[model samples]
Target: MPTILCQLEAVLRFLSNDPGDPNMQACRDGLRQAIAALKRHIQAGSSR
Candidate 1:
């Protein structure tokens, strides 16, 4: 799970300098949401 999160974060960083096109912006937003969701999941698991 951590591996997946790391890879997603790496991709987000790589896209940081991309042109401000609509598609790229959407992709970045989606990645951010996915990373947030994964972090929430991990935290929830740890509290059990």
Candidate 2:
């Protein structure tokens, strides 16, 4: 199964075209933040 990080990455890539809608833009921004946070968590966990 794909990890949450992978799934979120896919979603972000799908939205890379910039749909020109304010709502979609905000959603994309949120996704980017989520992805970043998830990545940091994963990295921190892996160091243990």
Q: Which residue window of length 10 is worst by lDDT in model 2?
A: 1-10
Instruction: Please write out the lDDT profile of model 1 over residues 2-36, one tens digit for every residue.
Output: 89999999999988788677899999999999999
Candidate 2: where is the Cα deviation over 4 Å? none
Q: Against the true structure, candidate 2 has what lDDT? A: 0.85
lDDT of candidate 2 over 11-36, digit per residue (tens): 99898777887888999999999988
Q: Quantify how close model 2 is to the true structure by its C-alpha RMSD in Å.
A: 2.1
Clashing pairs in 1: none
How many residue pairs in model 1 have overlapping backbones?
0
Q: What is the alpha-carbon lDDT for the whole of candidate 1? A: 0.91
Q: TM-scores of the models, in the given order?
A: 0.87, 0.81
TM-score of 2: 0.81
How many collisions per candidate? 0, 0
